[model samples]
Target chain A: MRRAAVSTLLWAYAAVALLPLLIMVWNSFRTDQELVVEPLGLPHSPSLDAYREAWVEASFSTYFLNSVLVTTLSVLLSTAVSLLAAYALARSRSRLMAVIEQVFVSGLMMPVFLMIVPIFYLLDTIGLASTRTGLILVYSAVSIPFSVFVLATFLRQLPVDLEDAARIDGAGPLRTFWSVLLPLVRPAVATVVVFRFVPIWNDFFYPLILVRDRARYTLPVGLTTFFGEYQTSWSTLFAGLVIATLPLVVLFLVATRQIVAGLTAGMGR
Target chain B: MNRRRTAALPTPVALLFLLPAAALFAVFVLYPMATALTYSLFSWRGTAQDAFVGPANFVALFTTEPYATQLPRAFGHNALLFAGAMVVQNSVGLLLAYALHHRGRLRRLFQVLYTMPYLVSPLVVGYLWSLLLSPLFGPVNAALRAVGLDAVARPWLGDPDTALWVVVLVTAWQWVGFPLLVYGAALGALDPAIEEAAMLDGASSRQRFWHVTLPLLMPVIGTVSVLTFIFSMEAFPIPYALGGSSGSPAGATDVMSLLFYRTAFHSGASNAIGISSAVAIVLFVVIVGISVLFTQWFRRVERRLT
Candidate 1:
């Protein structure tokens, strides 16, 4: 009886969480009026009109492409920069490592709003504000600390004997880092990629501040343009939302273990 | 083993990796923080030139008629959101984590489901929930009718009075799983026999939980709370996505971060950078104070626990 009760509560909470999602998907497949009238019931006649409207009317394609570009570049840059820094910190074992550690930790906690004016002024001074590259730089800088934390744990746990073995085999430090340590940290690297991608993909803040032109809009900020002055067509907005959300959700469902392992890197062990 | 390597790298290679991160952080973090401090003292425009206005800006921020209305509301709104998240998010998280601590067949399934909302973009969440809570034709209203609770229908995110709480509810829903998993990991590391002994005693489940489990959960709780507090102060996207930063319905949902954003950069405005930097500086000091206090508390808890 207790077991049954527990499962029932579990299922109910799951239902509460998933129900809104289901409603979004369902509404996107129906007429807006139909969604309003019989929202709790199955769709009377589903259609592809919302997706069509979102694409043709909303210019979602531009935003989607922008998201793809920004996500790819930011994740690549941040992960590359942090990986080298983390490897150096791991191997060298200097007091400067403590400074590096402190810098990243505070960066992690430092609210992005606190730096908005200065960064904007500086970016604008350099002629990069309101551009995709500017957003990419900001994303990379903000993401470094946590990525370092994740990579540091994994790299520290890595056996130094592997490097010793490679060095004795006549590999230099750089070559040993590549041939020996890099292969072992593939999971950590994937973690960094997804970690940066999901946030940059869905981010509305920096884009809202940085990107001025609608032509340069990323997905999340572009989706808001459809909201209008008062109300949006609910069905069409839902379609736009689903398209924007699906990539990360699909990736997450497939790689649940890696994400969890990354999040709980030190704590789990 | 020397291929010209003696405990270091050639300068160019070291600079190659470090330069990008260092340059960005310098321009963004260090200079911005310093700029915020200087900007807060005087009135200035987008450019470097400024007028020496002394502490007039600080005095104006306090004694000005408009700020009187703004400050209390911003702090109050954030506090309500913070308290709501602490109760709803952390408690639900602890319960879920406790229930799912053992790795059973359904473990992976629940984990994914719990973390699913977290993965969705915050903008989508704000959009999705506002749609769900729409009074005219939302499914929530339909479900309320189906369940014969029509009288409980609410304006939800629409009304000025209830809008902030609606944001808080959604925020809690999205973020709770994080703390739960953090605590769950810590709990999994604890020796089971100690908990078993307490349970085997004459103590009730409640007694054992309070006298034993809650105390043991303190360290993780401390760490998680500090993280949550910092996050809560910085959490702008959901509210911004929901009602917007200037806030809807007479700025009812405005937080300090949003206020600063609006003041500094109003939809690609050409100027107002200096004024916005001043607001951000005040925000920085507030954040630094809170984080330092939490760090001290975390250390105290750490020392006591260990």
Candidate 2:
């Protein structure tokens, strides 16, 4: 009886947890009138009209493309740069490297709130503001600390013999890092990519502040404007929200173990 | 192992490898932090500082009208959210972790389901809850009324009294999955031999958990606490989405991050940049203070446990 009660509780919470998503998927096909009249019921006749409308009318395509471009570039650049730095930090036997690694790790605690104003100014001064390149640079920069943390730790655990072998073969520092350490830390690279992708895609604050053009708005920021403009259209707004969220959800579903492991990897042994 | 062979790679090579990350960090993170500090010290109109404010911006946060009135109230809301997360979210996650710790297949299944919402964008979560809590068509109100408790059904995100709490619950709901997984992993990693020893000592289940399992999980708990506090301090999306950027429904849901965002970008108030920078500094100090405190606490606990 006790075991049954415990299982029941777990199952109940699981149901609660999944309910909103199920509702979202369900209501995206629903009309606003249907939603108001029978909010608890599944859609009697599901339609893709909301998705179509949100796509064409709400300009999610522009926002979607911008997000993809920014996230892909940012993650790729950040992870690659971090791999080099992580290689140096992990393989080196110097106090300076140790201190640099510590500084990078400590960067994890620095909130974007403190840096947003200055970053805006800095980008504006460099004439990169309101451009995808500017946003990409900002994303990559912000992501460096955490990626370096993960990558450095992963690289540190790897046996030093491979790099030694590469060195004996007369490989340069860049060659040794690329050929030896990079392949070995592929798992951490994937982890960093997945970890960084979600936030950059979902980020609203920077986009809201940095991007002056509506054409440059990422999905989250665009979706907020959509929410504000179409406040009354529940169905379309749900569609937009669903569209905005679907990529990360799909990524999480496909890479559940990696995402979970990557995130919790820092919780200590 | 030739020390001289490894040394041949040289400092320049390492420095070359460090250049890109160093450049990016220097430009974006370090410089910006220094800029925020400097900007906080001056009275600025738009992008240009006109006079040396000398801590006046920070002082004005307390002495002024909208800021002074809103700052404490916002902090109160943040404290309430923090408390709710610690007490409620942590407890739920802990209980779930304990119940599912040994369930194998069921545990993995629950882990996936519980963490599903967390992976969804916070903006989406905010929209979902606001829709779910809408008085007219939301399922929450519908379900409440259907169950014959119409009196308690509310415009959860629309009322001043209930808006902050609703946002708190949404924030907790989105994040509780994190601690659940962390605790589950920690519990799974506990030594089976220790658990067996505890059982063989004639300890009841409760005693076994409290005396053995709980003590061992202190490090993870501490880590999760600090993480929770930092994330909560920087929390912006959910409240911004549900309550609007002004932390609306009468600023009941206003947080420091939201306040800073508005002051700097949206407010258009005079010297808003300086004041907002001051707010950012406060947030930074709070986060750093909490992280250091928690790390020290975790070390002490680990030392005691050993």
Candidate 3:
């Protein structure tokens, strides 16, 4: 009886968790009129009209491309810089290095709202305001603290005998780091990459504030406006949401282990 | 091998390795934070900085008409969100984790399923929930009416009484997976011998859980609480997506972040920058202070456990 009760509770919670998405995908194929008439009913004949309308008319294609470009560039830039810094912080025993590490770690507490106004002014001063490049740069900066913390923690736990052996084999510092250390920390790198990717992909704040041009809008910002414009067209709005959500779902399915590992890494003793 | 060769990178090369991240962080994160501190001290004429008002902006924030009222209300909402998340999300997560730990069947699949909502954007999640809860055409109401329970159906997102709770529930729905995974991992790491010994001592499952497992899980619980506190206090996207930037339904769902956004960008108040920066600084101090204090306390507790 207890085992049955447990199973029932788990299954119920799982249904609650997934039913919304399933309903969304199920309804996206129906027309707005059909949805208004029967909000809970299945589509009579599934169609791609809503998808086509969202993709072609609503400019989700552009938003899709922009999201892809911005998320990819920002994650790559932040992860690359953080890896080098993590390596340095892991290896160095200097007092200054410790201070620098503290500086980066302290950034974990820095609120985005606090820095946003000044960042706007600073970006404008540098002529980067409203540009994808500027947004990418800000994303990188915001992501660096967490990336460094995770990578540095992982790097510290690694044994250094491999690096010593590489040095004995006449490998230079750069060569040793690139060839020896990099391969070993691949899991850490993957952890940082997955963790950074989701937030950057999902962030609407920076883009909403910094980017002015419609052409430059990322998916989250674009979807907000898209919803505004398509307020009456529920099916099309659902289609747009599905488009915004599908990539992450697919990615999660592909990389569940890595994502879980990254999420649960430091939580346990 | 020498200890130096084994551990230490040469200083020059280490600095070189650090340069890119240091530069980016200094220019973007550190510099802007410093500038925000400065901006919060002064008066502003539209976009331009004016006379140094010392703490007048902060004073106005606490004592003035709109801000005094708005700040406290928004702060209450945030506190409510934190408390709600702790009671609802974390508790549910612990139960789920405990069940999964014992069952072990389809654990990976369940983890993936449970965590799926977290991977999607909050904006999308918010929008999706808004549709589901929409009074006019939402299936929730439709199903309610269909079941002859029409009295239970109402404007969930439109009602001020229920709007903030909806946000809380949605936020919990998206994030419960985090605590679940964390607690699950902590449970897995626990030595089973202790629990077995308790079983031998004739402790009931409930007694063992309450006395043994719960105390051992205190550190992980503390960590989850701090994270939930931070996320709740800084919440934006769901509230923004569901309630708009002004935190609609007559500002019933207004949060500190939304308030800051409005004052800075939308309000067009003369000293918008100054006032908003003050708001930001207040939130920062609160978040950092509470987080540090709790983390230290949790560390002491963890040390005692061993």
Candidate 4:
């Protein structure tokens, strides 16, 4: 009886969690008139009209490309820089290194809102404002604190025998990090990538504020504008949402275990 | 544990490794934050810095007409969001985690299902909920009317009184997966022997959970609280997506970030930069200050546990 109750509860909660997205995806294939007539009914006849409209007419293609560029570039840039910084912090024992680590760690608490206004001006001053390059830089910089924290913690906990072996093999520091230690910390790197990728991909704030040109707008911004413009066209909006969300959903489906491991690592301790 | 291995990487090489991150952080993050601080002190005339106001903007923020009222009201909404999330979201997460911990069947699938919404953008989540709760043709109202509960069907997002709470519920719906995953992991890592011993001592399952399990999970609880608090205070996308930048329905769902956005960008006020910078500074201090307090308290709790 208890087991039955538990299973039922879990299944119910699961439905609550997933039914909205399922409904949204389901209804995207239906026309807006069908939706207004029967909000809960299955699509009478599935069509790709909504998808085509969102993609071709609404310019989701451009937003999708911009999102891909910005998210990939920022994630790669931040992860690389954070890896080096994490390695330095992990391998060093000096007071200066400790202070530097603290500086980076303190950034983990720095609110983006606090820096956004100033960042706008600063980027404008440097002539990078409203540019993808500027948004990428901001994304990379904001991501540093958490990425470094996670990577450094992971690196510190690693066994030192690998580094020692590399040293005896006549490998210098860079070589050891690149060839020896880097391979071992692939999971940690993956963790950082997974965590950072979601936020940068999903972020609406920075893109909304930083980028002005419609051509350069990311998906989140584009989706909002699309919704505003097509307020009466529910199916098209749903299609746009599916387009915006499908990549992350696919990513989650593929990397569920890695993402959970990344989130839960060092969590309980 | 080898000191020699630690010392092998010379300081210069270590510094070299750190330089890129340091430079990016300094220029982009640190410099911008410092500039925000400086910007708060000056009056602005349409993006150009005017005479140094020296806290005059802050004075207007706390003492003037619209801001004076809006600041407290928005902060209150944030507080309500934090409290609501704690009560509704985290507790549900804890219960769900406990169940999933005890019942292992389809656990991996459940984890994925629960966390999927969290992985998506808050803007998307907000929009999704808005559609679900739309009174005109939303399925929720449709189902209600179908079931003969037509009176219960109303414009959820359009009502001022219910708007903020709806945002909170939607937020909880989106993020409950986070605490579930965190707490599930924590529960998994727990040593079963202690609970077993407590059971042997004539403790009920409830007693064992309260006395043995709850105390042990306090630190993780604290960490989750701090994160929830920070996120709640910094909430923007949900309210923005749901209520628009003005946090409409007569500003019922207005939040600090939205207020700041309007002040800085949309309001076209003379001192938009200065006043908005002050708002940002206040938000920064509130988040950082309360987080520090929570962290200190969590350390105390951990120390006591040990």
Candidate 5:
């Protein structure tokens, strides 16, 4: 009886967690009229009207592609730069190295809001404002603190003998980083990739402020536009929400272990 | 001699490795911060510096009508959101962690499901909830109607009294997974023999939990609280999406971050980069203050535990 009670509670919590998403997917398939008339009922016809409307009329495809480009480029750039810095800090025993590590760790405390005003001014002055390239650079910059923090922490725990052996074998510092150390720290890289990619893909603030043109708006900003345009069209709006959420959900489902492991890597410590 | 011998790479080589990250950090973060400080001292319209305002913007932020009034109100909303998330989200997360810690088979599945929402954009989460709670066609109201609770199903996001609370609930719902996973891992690593000892001592389950398990979990709890507090202070997208950029419904769900963004960038409002910078500074101070306090307290608890 006690075991059954615990199981029931677990399942109850699961239901609460999943019910909204289930409702979202279900409503995405129905017409807006059907949604209003039968909000809780499953669609009788199961048409894809909402999805079709959102994709074609709402310009979700454009927004989707913009997000893909930004997220991909930013993650790649952030991971590479962070790995280099982490490799340097992790392997070196100099006081300067220690100080640099502390600096990056302290960078974690600096709020993004504090930088937003100045970043806008700086970007505008440099003629990079409202461009996808500009947003990509901003994303990469913002990701550095956490990326370095995670990568450095992971690297510190790794054995240094391999790098030393590579050096003894006449491998150059650059070569060792590329052919030796980088491959060994693939798990940490995966962690950084998963952690950075989701936020960049889901980012709204930078895109909202940086991208003035409607053509350059990322997914979150584009969704805001959709929300404004389709205020009363409930099913269509639901379909847009599902489309915005589906890629991340699919990515999370595929890389669930790595994502969770990356996110919670140091929490238990 | 020992340091030189043990060094893994040459100084120049190490510096070479660090250049890209350092340059990016300097250009984006450090440089911008310096400019934000300078900009806060001047009355700037967009990119043009009009005049040196010195501390007038900060003064107006503290003493004036809307800025002064709304800033505190927004902070109050942040406090309430922080408290609600701690009480509702973390508590449920704690319960879930306790339930799932020993159940090896289903833990991964539940963890992934609970955490999936966190990966989705907050914009999506906000819109998703708004749709879910739409009075005319939402499933929440439908369920309420089905169960004969029609009167209780009001316009959740439209009413000022309930709008802030709805944002709080939405944030908690999305974030509960973080604490669950953290606490679950902590719980799993706990030695089973300690719990057995408490059981053998004739302690009731409640006593065992409070006297044994709870004390052991204090350090993790402290870390989670600090994280939740920081996230709460920076919360924007949910309130922005649900309450509109104006934090409508009579500014019911206005938060510091949202207020800053609106004051600085909203085309409808007069651009007050100076005042907005002051708001950003205040927000920064509050976050740093809370983080220091939490870190000190956490250290104390960890010291006691050790």
Candidate 6:
């Protein structure tokens, strides 16, 4: 009886956490009248019109692709950098570690809002401001500290014997990390991908200022534009929200186990 | 053959691995931060070739109308948000972790559900909460009335006194699971015998937790607290959404992030990149100083605890 009641309370707490999303999903299905009139009730009948018009008319497909492209490039770039910096921090008791760690932490203080000012100037000077490359570099730079911190933590926890054994066999530093360490810390990569990548993917502040062109607009900014253009159309806006959010939801669903591991990786040590 | 071939090229090999990140950082991060300082010195708006003003921007920013008010509010709300996150996120996380500590079946279900909020964009989180608290038909008020608590309900995001806290709560709701998951792992590593020992010595469940569990979890708490503090400081979404495009309700929740946004590309105002750059510089210095202070404080606490 106690266990059942405890589980019930836990479920209630979980439901509270999920309440807004549940409401979003529920509201997205209802008609405007239904939404306002009986907001909490199940739709008398579900309709696909919102999802359909949202996808076809609003260019949500393009926004989705833009998110995919930006997130992919950003995560790849972040992961690549993190692997090297993390490896160095993990293996070498190099005095450089202290300095580099300081750099990373300070770099975290570089607000994305502030970066817009200088980066716009820099990118314009180089003719890359509104370009995809501009957003990619900005994202990778901001994310470097986090990626390095996470990857370094994971890398430090691994046993060093395999790498040592490989080094003795004349394997180089790069080769050992690639063949041996990469597989071991795949979870860390996934964690970085989820945590770091999601920010860049759904990054509204950057894409809003940096990329003015509609063609290059990532999902977050694109959805904002969609909201302004179709300001009165709540249904379509909700639909776009659903579309903009699906990829991360998909990523999370696939990596559900890894997500837990990722957060817990820092614990105990 | 083995010895000679093995010794071939280990020096530049690892250097190649570090190249991508280092080069990107040099050109983008390092360059931009340097340029921010240089741009601060100049009065131009970062467009069209113009003459440099040389420290004029900094002087004006210090004495200017918005900067004087702007810097403090941004820093103040930034501090408040940091505090809210620490208390709400850390406490709630610790509680959930405690609930899940001995429970298994419920753990799997709750873990997945709790993590859903962190996966979405903060803007969206803000938007979703706004939807729930719309004053027009927000489900929050709806629930209040439903449960016969109508007297206690209020428009959360519209009021001055409540908007900041609403933003804080919305932001916390999004990331609390993350810290909890982190702390849960920390708790699991704690020696079960410590709690057992306390229980045998006539300690209550609360006492065991307070005396035994809490101390052991300090390091993880330090890490999660610092991470939350830094992210909350720079985070732009909660204030932007809850405060609306204008960061409104008379700029009550207009934080540094939003202020920097407004002064720059105009998060909801006019676009003046020069002044925004100056704001950015100010924000950068303040955040760095705060980060240093936080680390020092954490070090002090760690020392005392040890």
- The per-model lDDT (C-alpha) reads 0.75, 0.85, 0.91, 0.90, 0.85, 0.75
Ranking of candidates on DockQ, top first: 3, 4, 5, 2, 1, 6
Report i-RMS for every model: 3.5, 2.1, 1.5, 1.7, 2.0, 4.2
* Model 2, span A1-269: residue lDDT tens: 17888899899999988988888888999999999999898989998889998999999999999999999999999998998898888767777888888878878877688788888888889999899999999899889999998888887777777778888789888788777777788888889899999888888888988898999989988988898898888889889988998898789878888977876775647
Query: What is candidate 6's lDDT per residue for A163-235, written digit by digit as tens?
Result: 7778888877878888988899987888888778667877788787789899998888777677668755666
RMSD to the true structure for each prediction, in A, is 3.2, 1.9, 1.7, 1.8, 2.1, 4.0
| Preferred candidate (lDDT higher): 2 or 3 | 3
TM per candidate: 0.91, 0.96, 0.97, 0.96, 0.96, 0.87
Evaluate every candidate with DockQ and list the scores. 0.50, 0.65, 0.75, 0.71, 0.66, 0.44
Query: Between candidates 3 and 6, which one is better according to lDDT?
Result: 3
Model 4: how far residue A39 lies from native, Å = 0.8
lDDT tens per residue, model 3, B1-306? 444437589888999999999999999999998888899999999999999989999999999979999999999999988988898765788999998988878988888788878778888999999999988789889999999999999999889999999998898898787888889999989999999999999999999998999989998899899999999999999999889988889999999999999999999799999999999999999998999998998899878875
As a whole number from 0 to 100, the lDDT of residue A28 in candidate 4 is: 91
lDDT of 3 by residue, A9-31 (tens): 88998998889988889889999
Any residue pairs clashing in model 6, and if so which? Answer: none
Q: Which stretches of candidate 2 lie over 4 Å from their true place?
A: B1-8, B297-306
Pairs with backbone N, CA or C atoms under 3 Å apart (clashes), candidate 5: none
Per-residue CA lDDT of candidate 2, range B216-290, in tens? 888889888887888888888898888888898889889988888888888888788989988888878877887
Q: How many clashing pairs does model 2 include?
A: 0
What is each model's TM-score for chain A? Answer: 0.93, 0.95, 0.97, 0.97, 0.96, 0.88
Pairwise lDDT winner, candidates 2 and 6: 2
lDDT of 2 at A189: 87
lDDT by residue (tens digit), candidate 5, B1-306: 122334376777889999999998889888998788777788766656788978888998899878889999999999988998899755788878887875777888888887766777888889899898888888898899899998999999889988989999999888888888888877876889999999998998779877888888878888888999999999989988889887888999999998898888873434478788889988998998988988997898789876
Model 5 segments more than 4 A misplaced: B1-7, B267-271, B301-306
